[model samples]
Target: MNWPQSFIKPKYLSLTYLLSLFLTLFFLSCEINYDGDERLLVTGRILNENNLPIPNQDVEFWIYKGSGAGGDDDLISLTATDNNGQFLMLIPSPNNEDGFELKISDPDTIYQHKILHRILDKNFTNYEYNIGDIVLYQHHVITNAYITFNKTTVNTSLMDVKFKGDADYLVWINEPETYYGDYEPTLAHDYYKNVPLNSTLTITYTIRDNSTETLSTHEATVTINNENLEYIINY
Candidate 1:
């Protein structure tokens, strides 16, 4: 039985190898389950058309439970942007078949609301997702018009102005709502208002002469486009 030491199986070495294999299997099982209380962090920024940060803006996050349009939405969190237009929040990781959405609104009525959607699978582990900058556009058009009278009189004044446009167009006259004083007759008046972008706008101007009791009106039609923010009208 004492042939040589090399022919003998070391019991200590065999036990050490079995213990290492058991530890490896245990760690692998823990990773599969991922049974931890860790959360996912998300951060982003909001900006306007001028590439400026929009501070004190509200942002919302929602999670989709089911599939397709019939899915139920679960509100996760709501936060506001800081002075620098930065936002950060933490939410639980969605299930393997779930999705998420983010929404931001323009409360000042200067820009349009933004909504983004994403589907996060199981591959997305505990990590911080930075969405960078989200830019919004101006919802309405700021149109300005300048007026000139064909014949200037001592009692000439701007009476009023009216605007008409296509079915989807909305117009509001902002300046010269009332008649100007005869002593303060001016050659120009600015008509500034917000209207829908990319539409046809028809402007009508009214001029009055107190002494002669004469009322004059003029009409002009112009197509409002993104490039034409401000417009000029002659009467």
Candidate 2:
């Protein structure tokens, strides 16, 4: 008198349909990153250049405003490393923010603050994300070395002055070459570079004499320290 269970499939088909719907929604959510409720459990360890754990190191999570935002970065969360130099953060992924930055500050202020940025596309679906280990270095005390290029002759010549030093070595042209009215690189590219304490720099100048149509090279080496801050090169 009753319809067979196989023939009456509405109840069974509805259950299957609901299950499929749930799975589809779950995957769809994962595909769309930066969901409102999405969050990350971040973990990392802080160490010094000497391979020693840095305890009490500040850890700040920030939602970096992309270029042209014209606003300050939004702070997400702030914490510090434990005694063992380990840190963990439960931070949210904002739907509006396009980038994230982690600021690791040294509590003692000896080391320069580290900025970790350019992290945007990540698996927000994952329960945890580990940033691994970070190393901090103490701020290097730098001494500025001023340079002056003295031309030996008023005749026009091709002079190329080059310098080699650490990354901090910089050449800042505060005054344009028009100040000296010379087209030579010695006057045009003449600038000072910051030399860290106990750092050395090599200064080389290549001169192309227009009168003789020949080239001459000269080299000089100098070390910068607390006692020796001035490095003057003459051409």
Candidate 3:
């Protein structure tokens, strides 16, 4: 008598599961890396509050537990970022996976940790997915930090500014329309979060001098401490 093709014996399934467990442990012990274009490749960049790369930080990938059928939350792989604060996770996509999570953490109390939840729209699109940029805020806080851009020349056309992270009325990438020249403290665009404390914010702005009819490029830096420190930009 022969069994059905799709029918898996309970004992056989247990053995296969055990074997996979052994393999996962062995691979992790040897090298926290897996390679191949066919595998599911997840990548991201890790940065500090000041928008600086964080190297050698711990990163992990976990698959959620499937309902009634699959096992518990499966930790597929573990790895760390390179000198450039970049990480790559290559693993075989499991069967019937609802979603997954990418966890970034530090064992040493240097930087605060983060967990990113990703839900698949039916399934993944490409072999590679990039999570653009991630900022891990270090342990600290700035009670009152602000920025004031003063117009040096009269009749200035427009002003634009950028920061290493979010602010009251500023987004790291683009300027919010509601924020004319003042920020009330909020968040937006490209991984928005509360202002990072005790960090140096780099500001690059383009101010058009109407009288000169030329664009001026300027750079400035301001360090935020316990007091009300303002990043004054004279454009």
Candidate 4:
């Protein structure tokens, strides 16, 4: 006669034991964050006068000085506006017993705007303000617009270039309107994928708007093997 299966229990509660271990760990972790109030954080948002979100605008806060330390030029914390012109910034309490101030800056401007100035109370946190729609004025002058290459060479090869400008424009080969073709969005962010490298290479630029033409063209000639390669017409 065979002993019944239940007559002898398994030496180990393998499955049951493993499950209990896992559950214990999970419950322990839950106890840590169970309060849900530990994350008590100070938060705020920024909006335009029209109650619109201003994206990419920088906001800063600084410590205040009552002794006419107005020229204390250092930023404690900075937060940028989001696409909706809204910002959620976090500010830590000051280490010393000093006053505090707040300032906002427009990314497009040469210098940022000083939005607010005041002394901070001991109980300072969770600040909010509606800066309104900030007018982004043009700061880049087109007169100095042009392409720059690493080095003009005699070898017939292509080289990548870093193009920096205010807008996504085109680089013409010869005159503003003349070129191999219009190459753009040109390296996306301040970079060109492939640029031609020749002994005598000349390049110009054209604005996005075809109606307005460039005032002048900028050209760079490559010195290959200590020889000059001229491509211009002879009189």
lDDT by residue (1-235, candidate 2, tens digit) is 8999878876647877889988877555443145658677878898875678889989987774444434335677899999889999987666655566678888788865777755564633376767777766566654567655556655535355666763231112122233332345444444565555576778777666676777788887877776435555544
| Per-residue lDDT of candidate 1, residues 147-209 (tens digit) | 233434567666455666432112111222233412235555555444445766787777677
Instruction: Give the TM-scores of the predictions, in the order they appear.
Output: 0.43, 0.45, 0.45, 0.31
Cα lDDT listed for each candidate: 0.61, 0.64, 0.62, 0.39
Q: Provide C-alpha RMSD values for all models, in order.
A: 23.7, 15.5, 14.3, 20.1
Model 1 lDDT vs. the true structure? Answer: 0.61
| Cα error of candidate 2 at position 211, Å | 32
Candidate 1 TM-score, C-alpha based: 0.43
lDDT of 3 at 80: 96
Clashing pairs in 2: none
lDDT of 2: 0.64
C-alpha RMSD of candidate 3: 14.3
Clashes of each: 0, 0, 2, 9
| Candidate 1 clashes between residue pairs 3 or more apart in a chain or in different chains | none
Mark the regions of model 2 whose C-alpha exceeds 4 Å error after superposition: 1-36, 68-72, 123-127, 140-235
Could you give me the TM-score of model 2 versus the true structure? Answer: 0.45
